[model samples]
Target: MIIVIVALGGGVAGGYALSYQQAQQSVLKTSVPKELAPVIAAYETVTNNYYKSVNTTKLTDGAIKGMLATLDDPYSVYLQNNDKTNLDDTISASFGGIGATIQQNHDSLSIASILPDTPAKKAGMQVGDVLLKVNGKDVSKQTVSKAVAKIRGKIGTTVAVTVKRGSKQATFSMKRQKITVDTVTGQLASANKQVGVITISTFSEPTVKQFKATVKKLRKEGAKSFVLDLRQNPGGMMSAALSISSMFSKNGQTVLQVEDRNGAKEVYKAGKKLDDGFKVTEKTAVLIDGNSASASEITAAALHQNSNIPLVGEKSFGKGTVQNVGEMGSNKELKLTIAKWLTPNGTWINHKGLTPDIKVDYPAAAKITLINATQLKPGDKGSDVKSLQQMLTALKVGSVTVNSQYDDATQAAVKTFQQANKLDATGTADQDTLATLAQKLSAQLTKDDPMMKAAVDAVAK
Candidate 1:
């Protein structure tokens, strides 16, 4: 598909999302001090004596941003109208745009992910594919924001995008839609029937609700233990994180300790208000990686501190400050870093990240070719059988051991899976059956998903 790269109309945030909570706050109202006479005089001079007509809104916005810049905090900013809209979309997990995350690579803009069920994913845009053009406009030299603006348009409008995947180039005509992003996904594991896994992408407004409902459903479906995966999750909502942590922790357990400017501290504890019904099994684990930040770190710290869940994977991205996004008049916003949050044990996780209880690096995927089979009966034996077994195991299908042998057990599992998937049940692992299984099993894990396996092992052991 030839995706035309064009010059965009507006700038876009790179994978923008916000972690925010609206609560009863005590605002210390202050009058404008006399120290700002110089600033007001400059504004008056520019408005009155500037050579041309001035945009007072732009000037005021720039001035507010300039004042914030003196604080040396990147998170604190004066949000313009568009910036506020983006933040709102991020917090709500719904936006009107082509749902694909792009990152600037060494030499090109590469697709990082295509949001599920979105036009980008439907058009078969794969991760790591290099963007060639948008609507025949070359985007090789354009900034990500500029490129994104060009890619996004009115709902139902079509945009052509060209990308280079390996040695071949393809173009796709994709329509913009109102995409609702799901932050949490879950599944039962084949390696261990007792364990269910949940991966959290971010802590949006609805994330805690999703987490509770999915986990409860998993429990009802016979999942005894659970693995909470927070790898690559650039965190959102502090309140959401606390809510999730409360499910695992007992009442009165500390969720966070906020230290304000004057060294005053405020401790947030897990209350007994929410009773997430599942009895978190003793083997429950929390997974973390370098990209896990803010609220993710909070959740990890809370779970490990109170429930003693084994945190598995690499160290997290330490971002412990709390930012309060306040409405600045009309459509403007002001995100100010009000306090620094500490872990339950009073450890400050600023630039220094939290260490996992079981620090295991990701293992390499086993090299295996995707195979097609007509029908495998009880007597089949080979690498193909082993590959099928591996895939099935990752999907948490029935007890088909990866021993390179298709026995009666394997056939039984195949029949059950086919029946559940609404496929013709011939008690065999055929090509169509395997493809259907792949679709259902893609998000849970792959044949060689090292982290998923580690999580399963951590609990199973």
Candidate 2:
């Protein structure tokens, strides 16, 4: 009787255990979708055996990350809650870092350009600098996201960076801080006192407002000519470029025309109102380089064809393709090329960039020089400086020394020349200054400097 009772007890306990296992299986079967049931069952079988012996049940974070890594798209990344918040701040154009525009080149990351006045620039970071390591870790195998995560930190904190510039490996200790990107730099040029020099880095939301204010201020200060510099601009918001271009053109003028693959065309036009308070009557010149692209090209094309603004410098970077950012589910986004743009004269500058009306190749020897000052030196005094100074004196400014020394006196005379001509106080002799100077010097000599002579002839026309 005692043996039989023990057998019955064992049977009851075994039956209870079987029932519990069936209940757990039923729950999982109901929870998993039909298509995923086989996968879930296989996972459960392995995990169950492991859990039965080890008593551990939670999934590892690394396992989750591994699943995300299987996706091939570079932009499709899995971010934790904390990382997601940081990324949002970065895309919103506000974050703390060394202030550089960076892009990934395969496994290697390269610096596109160092923002002016940022800690990166202050630390001597330059365009084309290749990042090698961060914080003592080898970043050669890391993704751009991983490298960026290691580089970014709280404002006022210091981070170490290793970069390869040509043959040398450079290490810099950079401080992290909030970087306010100065998109537009404006000043009055001494060469054409009547001309305002505006260099736009990128077209952002605030750019149009800033540009309008600068135009108004420059006109009040007596600027009658303009030189717009769009060199090395990678382009930005389309609306911003349109707004800025509108400031220079009359109403109903097309700034840019977009044509998609579906045969649909859209024309962006300028508003009738001029922002300079007065009419834009001055001759305008645009300077473009190989790095100017997209919206930068739009601005150049609009003013060039519509307003007949003469473009100087090299041909622009041919990137007239437009991209639209499409948001997929689960924070995944796609930036697909959607359309191509054309100039007002129906020129497609996709692979072939816009050719300058006046092409000026940067001298091979002058590649390292920062400023492009055109004034002649004391020893080389027969150039345009003496002629420009004389022209300035005629414009009611006091007589200049015209000694060809770029001394304090020369700079002062240039400033006075700029003031009389109603230009910004930048003492550099630019296209406008050279143009006006050529006109004054033409009376003294029959032979003309090629560029100055052209400018004088254009102004006369």
Candidate 3:
């Protein structure tokens, strides 16, 4: 069986360990050949002569993983029970967790992004927040997969998390719930009403269906052109990608090419019947970024090649390979890098990813929230002043204490903020300064994205 998925996690329950042991027993019976006598001798010696009580099951699993590791293939990995389960959940586009995307960076597992309205977001978790501790146990040294397992739990169960945001450490206890990820969402750009923006979080079984529905809704709501946003999408099912691409491509049109290890080639083409629901007259721009990988690249390439849709934003993540997950044992699955994904135009998009037709450098400024107006010159004492101080602190303004009273120090900080933002250097917190602060705060919170702005411009008649 072939399945595509993107996830990071660790072991499951003890049942998996037993299933793995049984699988190893079966493998030992047949997989090793007579030329591997040395290996068999080593295994027997370790089992018979080792002084400590050795876990033979773990040793066997480790041996299998060690053999695969010698191939030096990053995509090939030992899938523990939890890893398999996580893959399944990712493929289905739902799981029980706090709804934060985690990635292993240089030295730590940090929050790559937070899914809006999920438990993570509800708990005020922000992107780049480092996982400090889980349930009071320091997990800074744990792998991304292991940390994810720690964070995930049964629905409605609460997990305590300590996150490090710069020098500040905040602990939060949040309830875990089933997170249903919306792969496709559409909204008419507020800045350009004629241009609709459809953000595809990833390609899953439900993605194509959601994309079709969203596009239809946008069209009915007077969206004349569209932007397909694939920024930060880590990719999912290949079938989902192709099916979604068929919406914009002609029937029987070549969408992608696949070349396996044995040099066998296969071309995937749109079916005999196309999705006529996708209005051809509506121009499209696909938004891509460093996180756009695999199926996301396929969709971007297919649309750009077949329909001349302009690609906007940064170059893609360059993960243009297909992973086929096959069953190893009853409950164990082995994922192998089966094929390299080729564009319809026969470009091999491997390590060298697809470059966007239009390169747009959007500002990565912090999100801003519009704050309530507080007209205060000085000698102000109230909760509003404290709120302003908090907002100022978030903007990295220095020395603004979170006291309810606003003194001369508060005025000086306000002046500094105004100067930095290129507004009039006013010493007082007036309407203009408050409005500017609100706008700056609001900038950090703009989820619509500036890439959509460039895309709208490209499609605007």
For residue 135, give model 3's deviation from the true position in Å.
4.6
Angstrom error of the Cα, residue 367, model 3: value is 12
TM-score of each: 0.63, 0.55, 0.68
Higher-scoring candidate on lDDT, 1 or 3? 3
lDDT of each: 0.71, 0.61, 0.72
For model 3, where is the 10-residue window of minimal lDDT?
85-94
- Tens digits of per-residue lDDT for model 2 on 1-461? 45554445766566555555655576566864455444444455545545465422224333434554565433333333223211112211366788766555434566654554466655545555788888778886565567777878788887777788665565566668887666676777645556677777676667777777777788888776667778666676677777777777887788888999997999877664423332355777887877777788988988888988887778988878775654534543444457888888778898788888988774332122121233433233432454445555544355567554455555676676666667665776654454344333333222222333343234334
Model 3 residue runs over 4 Å out of place are 1-31, 85-97, 101-132, 139-178, 272-281, 364-448
The prediction achieving the highest lDDT against the true structure is 3
What order do you get sorting by TM-score, best first?
A: 3, 1, 2
Best by TM-score, which number?
A: 3
Against the hidden true structure, what lDDT does model 1 obtain?
0.71
C-alpha RMSD between model 2 and the true structure: 16.3
Task: Predict model 3's lDDT versus the native.
Answer: 0.72
